[model samples]
Target chain A: MSIEVENIHKQFGSFTALNDVTLSIPSGELVALLGPSGSGKTTLLRIIAGLERADSGRILFNGEDTTEHHVRERKVGFVFQHYALFKHMTVFDNVAFGLNVRPRGTRPSKSEINAKVMDLLRLVQLEGLAQRYPAQLSGGQRQRIALARALAVEPQVLLLDEPFGALDAQVRAELRRWLRKLHDEIHVTSVFVTHDQEEALEVADRIVVMNKGRIEQAGTPDLVYDHPANPFVLNFLGNVNLFHGRLNQPGADQHGADENAVSYVRSHDIEIERSPQDSTALKAEIRHIQKLGPSVRVTLAIDATGEFIEAELTRDVFKNLGLQQSEQVYVRPRQVRVFVEDYQI
Target chain B: MSAPTTTYAAKANDNHRITEPALVRWGLTVVALVFLAMFLVLPLAAVFSQAFEKGLDVYLTALKEPDTLSSIKLTLITAAVAVPLNLVFGVMAAWAIAKFTFPGKNLLITLIDLPFSVSPVISGLIFVLLFGRQGWLGPWLDAHDTKIVFAVPGIILATIFVTFPFIARELIPLMEAQGRDEEEAALVLGASGLQTFFRVTLPNIKWGIIYGVILCNARAMGEFGAVSVVSGHIRGSTNTVPLHVEILYNEYNYTAAFAVASLLAFLALITLVVKTVAEWKVRQQLGR
Candidate 1:
């Protein structure tokens, strides 16, 4: 279902957990609420699920106002970060819980419940472990069972809070792909919260970056990564070489910099050369060289400001240039996004 | 030089061992066993021996007496009423304390534990002051011809007061540790409030409830000091098993008194067994 959160606000005693925030999510799209700890992403997700009440907000699910609905009436499926599976229940019973708890008049038949539970189990590829308890399964398997259990009710929307946050790296990678495939098959309007930028970029069709109780930026993964709306998004998304210097307007004398403007560039955007060829080049000394599988990382210390900057170069280029530690080099921005000191988005 | 050094190192390792020597360990074990025999085994053996001294016929006669039979029935009835009341109170108290945050929560918890720290006799006296004929509600109760103190109701009240904290004490920590995530999950899946409680919360805390109920039942059945103060010791009517034993003992009927006491001892043993089984079940549930 399409979700519209309009001007949501939440507070806990003296701390404001969420400010006036608004977001729109289209049906059948997977979106990730990405942020660091205490960034209010999880709070927003909970508000949408009706697990928490926003101090002032209106939530609409497919044009129906759901702000007054109780959690039980919302028909929103939620998967917790800790895989809050009932320990006393078998996998099959956990999946069958929603159907079994239906009011008597509209309840499904015994055979129908059994068939549906089995179908969910098969969908999660956990049919063989239906008799096992949650504690008996691995972390990844438990989360999968939790997902299946949430989907058993055929909810209009699915909400996951850090769905793979507790798993190790390898398992997390595998589950990310599996979750993408599952979304393709079912196409339920899904929102998941995550602190891992890589996981968010890899798994979500659209990413909403949050910071300090506000939405910093929201766009497709590539858009948010390449064209961040502000410094917060740029620094949060990936590594960048921050240069504190005045910006010179196009066609302006290179030596006469505008003292008010400062700029930063991504590590890959900064180019390195053995000799200074132009007035734009800034001389620096190479301090450290790291040879990662296909790329070389060169750490440079600028002579003018004594600031260190990193430049990523391919292994072939590093070898052709004959770069060495403690060697002098000139650096210039091949492509950079410059922001003035008082810049605002 | 290497051989001699190795031997010396081994000797030092033996001297530096953390555990006591074998002889000291055996001595401590013997001491523990002696202590148990003196305190536990002796009392248990004496009860049985004294009860059977005049032979099985007298033992049977004592048990068959009308007053003894009536006392047994009274004790059972009191336990039946008191235990279930306390069980419901405990569940409600635990649910409120574990699952909700509000003002005066700590104070409420402290008040729930009030009965535990207060002496049983004092608890009975508190009720007596409240409901006794010469006490605060005495005039009103007397005018209505309703007797609470020195009656079966008084005995039940005292028993309940002593057993009030058992179930809540058992449940609060367990429920608090389990948290509200599972219940929230159930609600989000379209389960009603009652359904979430019965299907999700109850199953997770089943062992804790069983553990609490067993302890509550034991206390309700075996309480003596509190029940004695309120029961008034009226023969065949108000005297519980413990008070009945006291009356028999005062009349110099040692065998009869010990016989009745032995029945209570047997009840204690059963409670111990049930408690052990419940604890084992809790461990098994948690271990999984």
Candidate 2:
């Protein structure tokens, strides 16, 4: 089901958690709410799930207004950070709970409930753990069981709040990949909250970057990475070499922006050459160079701008050039992304 | 001179040998054993030894008296009413205090703890001041022909007052420590508020609740001063076991009083067992 949150606002006492935040998830899209801690990403996801009420807004599901629906009436499945499994119940019983507690008119027979729970358990590859309580399972297994329990009710929208936040680094990566695969197979409209930028970039079809109870940016990972709407988005997405330089005409009008417009270039787009011959090239002395697995991060000072520039190079390219610290090099900007200072905020 | 020095050295060695770590540890254990024997074990032994001194038939005859039987029955009845009521109040208060923040929260918490700090005798006096014929609201109660003081209600009120904090005190910290995450998760999973409370919140706090119930019941059953003040210590009407024991002691009926006190002690022992089991279960669950 498609989910639409229109101008949602939430406040806890004097602190605003969400400020007129708006977003829409098309049916079957696995959108991610990504931000750092206290960034209001989780709050937004909770509002969507009806676990938290929005102070001012409306949430529509499949084009019908569900702003006043209770969380139980909203039919949104949720998986929590710590699994939040019912410690007293078996895996099968936990999964069958939603089905068994169906409202007045909708009742499932014993065999039907059992079949549905087993099917969900099988789907999560936890069929053998049906009789075991949640405490018996490992962290990853418990999370998978939490997922299966969320799915057992056949919810319209699946909401996960920092679903892998508590797991170890290795398990988190595996679960992210597995979740992506599962989302593809299930084709459920899912919204998952995460503070890890890498996890969001890797797992989400579209990422909503939040900051201080507001959306900083929202787009596909590539778009947000390559073309950040603001400095916050750029710094949040990944490492960047932000240079303060005025855009000079290449003797004529550039691709789009007028001359004298200030712009910045991404580290990957800056070409470092052995010779300082190009007219557009800027001369710099390397200060430090750290060898990453496939790429080398070179920190250098740009002579004209007196700004620190971070440059990235592939291992093969660095080896071929045989660069060293304190070595003078020329950097030519192949592509520059421009932003007017007045329009930044 | 050399002989004298050698003898002195030998005495020093003897002192050092006597002050070994093992010797110190044993000394400490002996001291603890003496204290336990004097205070706890000896007193209990005295109660049992004195009760059976008159033989089994004498104890049976004492128990057969209508006053003793009625006091036991009344005590049990009061406990039955007080324990469950305290349990409900404790859970509700814990839920409210641990789960929400509101105005007068600190004051409300202090009020919950008042029964623990106030003397049991004072607790009975407060009830008497409000419910006695010459006290506040006494006129209204008298006009309505309600006999709260010197009756079962008065006995229950005193028991309830002293035992009020036990269950809630056990549960509040536990519930606060567990937090609202599990309940919120249940809500998001479409569990109704009541279902979430029973299935998620209750299971997690069950041990705390049990621990609280045992403590409340123990206090409720053994309460003496407060119930005596409010129940008027009437022989057949409002006399509780503790009051009846006091009456027997005053009448020089030593064997019977000791017998009844022993019974109350046994009930307290049962409560202690329940508490130990609850603690063990909590420990085992946490260890896993």
Q: Kindly report the interface RMSD of candidate 2, rounded to 1 decimal.
A: 1.6
What DockQ class does candidate 1 belong to?
medium
- In the range A79-198, model 2's lDDT, one tens digit per residue, is 999887877789888888888767757868888988999899999899999999888999999999999989988899999999999999999999999999999999999999998889
Worst ten-residue run, lDDT, model 2 chain A?
A: A247-256
Per-model TM against the reference: 0.90, 0.88
Candidate 2 ranges beyond 4 A from true positions: A247-345, B1-38, B101-103, B284-288
TM-score computed on alpha carbons, candidate 2: 0.88
Instruction: Report iRMS values in order.
Output: 1.1, 1.6
Which window of ten consecutive residues has the lowest lDDT sum in model 1 chain A? Answer: A248-257
* CAPRI tier of model 2: medium
Q: Where does candidate 1 clash, by residue pair?
A: none
Each candidate's root-mean-square deviation in Å?
Answer: 4.5, 7.5
